[model samples]
Target: MISFLRKIRQKLLSQNRVTQYLAYAIGEIFLVVIGILIALQINTWNQQRIENNEELEILLGLKDEFENNLEELNFSITINTKVTEACVQLTQLIRSNSIANDSDLLDDLLVRIGTFNSFDAQTGVSSEIVNSGKLTLLKNDALRTRIINWLTLLIDQEEDILFRSDNYTMNMMPFLMKHFPLANGELTKKLPFDKKKYLQNYQEKSPFKFNIAKEEYLEFENQIWHHKHNNDYVSINELNLKDFLKITLQMIEEELNKKK
Candidate 1:
């Protein structure tokens, strides 16, 4: 093709039809420019196609990750609710000075309050996308924004969980250890391996049993009250994260559908 074009240019110049030659030269230049532009346009379209496919894959991955996270979040919420309820029941019993009647129930409530629950989100897809600067590949502005917000919410939720954990570890556990036998609470827990059997094997029984005095009940109640509020904060944050996950998943679904 180059040789043919060169031959045409040589023939034009040999004829010395200067006006015609100049016109042919201009036309040839215009065709070369047009060809280059067409090639560039084709390359642009190919690049866009590759990006669209990549974005679709990212959306699919995000959908799966967020769905799993939603399930885990719901489980955490349920556990948090149980913890809150246990706190409330214990508070009622302490306030009424009726806790002395049911040692077993008190033990069960104590076990529940002592158990810690936190939402463990699957952040693999989202974190990689954000950290690797691939979030922008998600062309939908709203979806991109939601994904960023989801990461922010995850951080906020983690902070709330840490606060709750600190309260449980620092305030509640110390108080309980001082006043009550931890084995009593452990007996209430249902583990895969029989905890009661394990304790019996070890011949471990606290000689000092849990005996809450009327005056001490107020102090214990204060601990439960604060722990209840901590649980509440965690629950609220989990709920918000759940909402964000649902919205993000829905947006991902929409984007995936567009591909179909």
Candidate 2:
């Protein structure tokens, strides 16, 4: 094509057709510019295609991660709900004064007292996107904002988990160990703390009975307060985390629907 155009220009020059040669020269320059523009446009299209594919992959990965997170979060919520209910039952039983000698009730309360539930959201895909500077690839403004907000939500939940766990560790466990026998028994497995010694120490009673003394009852009340505190703290955060997961999952579905 270049050779043919050059031959035309040479012929025009040889004939001394200055007006025709200049017109042809301008036309040739216009064609070259058009070709360059077309090449640039094609390159841009190809780059965009690659980016779209990457965004889809990230979205799919996030979908799987969040789906699993949602399941775990729901389960945690259920467990925490049970903990809250058990706390309420124990509190009522202690406050009533009518059920003080109910050893069977004590057994149930002991099992309930040992329960704890927590959740940790998965951030593998989100962390990669944020760290690698690929958040812009999300394309959907709503989706990107929610994905960024997930980190903040996760941090809040983790802080609450730590706070509640500290309550159980520093306040509740020490109180229980000091006042109660904590003998080795089947109940050991149910409690969140170290069960090895409890398992080895008392193998006779499945649910060891503790005679509720005045001081022990007082300590039980104190321990129940801490348990309730932790339960409330965890329950509220768990609900919030669940809500965030649900909303983010909805946004992901919307984006995926758009792609389909």
List candidate 1 stretches off by more than 4 Å: 191-207
- Which stretches of model 2 miss by more than 4 angstroms? 184-203, 206-212, 215-219
Can you write out model 1's per-residue Cα lDDT over 26-103, one digit (the tens) per residue? Answer: 999999999999999999999999999889889989988989989888888888888899999989878777666777
lDDT for each residue of candidate 2 in 1-260, tens digit (9 for 90 to 100): 88999999999999999999999999999999999999999999999999989989999999999999999888888878887887888788888775546645655665665667778778899999988999999989988888888898788778878888888888887766664445532443354444464533334663533455665777778789877887788788888878888888888888888888
By lDDT, the best candidate is 1
Cα lDDT, all candidates? 0.84, 0.79
Count of clashes in candidate 2: 2
**Cα lDDT for residue 62, candidate 2:** 95
Prediction 1 global C-alpha lDDT: 0.84
Pairs in clash, predicted candidate 2: 184-198, 184-202
Evaluated with TM-score, which candidate comes out highest? Answer: 1
